[model samples]
Target: MKTQRGDIPRRLDTPDPAIRFYLFHGADEASSRSHATRLLKAFGAAKDAMEGGAIKSDPAKLADEANALSMFGGAKAIWIEPAADEIVAGVEALLEAPGAEHPTIAIAGALRKTSKLLKATEASPHALAHISYAPEGREYENIIEQLCREHGLAPAPGVVSRIAGMTANNRELARQEVEKYALYLGSGESDPVPLEDDVVDRLGAGTGDVAFFGLGDRAMVGDIAAVQEGVDAMSANGSEAITILRAMQRRIVMLAPMQARVAAGEPASAVISSMGRALFWKDKPVVTEMLMRWSAPRLARLGERITDLERRMMFTQLPAKSAIGEELLAVARIAQSARRR
Candidate 1:
């Protein structure tokens, strides 16, 4: 029997017991589990009727279990962990068979373009969805904003970018950090407060210098003494010059878009909200004012300089101290320029 294929079905039809299967692949265990739970719940009352089980790397058992009938009243759901080629043949067999008996859900840790499992799942009547662990560009920012809104907090200005950079493309890690921050702030506040560097430092211990974001914020606020203190602390913590440069680079990139949006008369609240869900702290107003002071031309110049410094840091073997010092000086100069403006 030829099974239906294309986009995965989001919901199952009732009266007649229809088996619905979903496939999710990703490195982030949290994301995979979250997606699986959502699909399971979407099946309505049938969710309770569904028998749940997991399939290992073996394919024969996977096929047999998927083809088996449900014990109770409703459909059966089978989640295959780390779907690999060895299991693809069995999965394909199950897909090819008439799926009148049960529903199957496969959860994979990773997926390749040429995998038979992916192709079969994609082509099968079962629903197929993917969850990536990698934080792609603005998606991380979007997630942070959503989380903030859910927690009834506002993310301080530049917080999203700072958090995003610190996590270094790890969404699950970023999510954990955000959750910790929210917890620290407590859930009772009616208005959002600015998250302090100490909070972030406590959450992201031993990864790198926490003062990077604090310094960036101080620079944004045109606080020379605070910025200098942050730099000094960062240096003392054994942070490399290139790392500092990279942090500065990330800040400039985050600020450029924000400054542009703000200059066009966009509401600060709307601008920050659009960036992501993280609650903006009290310092948002200060950050907003800093954005207004920088102007587009100056921001552009800073970006260009940061990019050049980043290239040198990546390609050359210059002393870490000298390289970092130059970047710091550049940041200080830009802050001065913004203050003057």
Candidate 2:
């Protein structure tokens, strides 16, 4: 069965022992592994259960390990870490003749949503697939609350917003920061403590700045030089290509609908003014400029291309930075072309 990220907690609360195979795949590696660990624990398996196996995309060996008797001869939990597309065949074999003594959870890296491996796992009667993405909006809030409940911390009102501001688009980092905050509060204490705004600021210091800092706004406005500079700065600061690309993708999603409205005969100034009220104060200027620069059709095309770029970054071994750079430059070229016309 396909599972939503938010549903994972509820599902774990009442896990199905009969579901012996779990496919945890997504760009969010931290969230994926975290979920896998929870699934293993649900099956009464230790965190170190994968240490005993010869795993990693070897389907035949995976099948053998699944069917093979454990040293203790009880329910076994075998993990396949960083499972690639090659493991699909092995997973297929296991499903055909599932003698799985324990849950065989496969933790995969960023996979295309239409991946054959992912599809196979989802289609299997005995397997559950959970796709993890970066948490946002209400989902992000829910994660904060959930983490607080798990670690016995009470969140003061608006603490979630403060935590969200500090974390900024990274689910794993947010989770870790929450845990750290909880630890700081509970140190040498016998009971949970209420997490206040001051405590949050103190514990979450130095986490407010995101690596991809203004790149998204630059990309939206077709400021290619600024975007390139931002990318370089972010790379120097230890940001990943996927992280930068995701930031750009978010801008595209936000701009596409507004551009579409403009194309359908709304005035750009009116649209910008309306959207500005809804947009975060800091982002309104660039978004307004981009709305003026891009037409409806062009923004739609950009949206499609951005989606494709995201897929390539996730599934292919192609140079993500190069691909993203080329695409952003192309967007800048479009702006240049518009100016000439």
Candidate 2 residue-wise lDDT, 214-315, digit = tens = 455566666778867755654432335555555555566667788788778787667777853245444566676887877767767877886687677666
Q: Highest TM-score among the candidates is held by which one?
A: 2
- Listed per candidate, the RMSD to the true structure in angstroms reads 9.8, 6.5
Stretch of 10 with least lDDT, candidate 2:
47-56
Please report the TM-score between candidate 2 and the true structure. 0.63
TM-score of each: 0.48, 0.63
Error of 1 at 281 (Å): 14
State how far residue 76 of model 1 sits from its true place (Å). Answer: 8.1
Note the Cα lDDT for every prediction shown: 0.58, 0.68
- Please provide, for model 1 over 213-254, each residue's C-alpha lDDT reduced to its tens digit, 9 standing for 90 to 100: 445555655667775665566554234444455455555666
Those runs of model 2 whose alpha carbons end farther than 4 Å from true positions after fitting are 1-7, 48-58, 67-76, 110-114, 156-158, 187-192, 205-230, 236-341
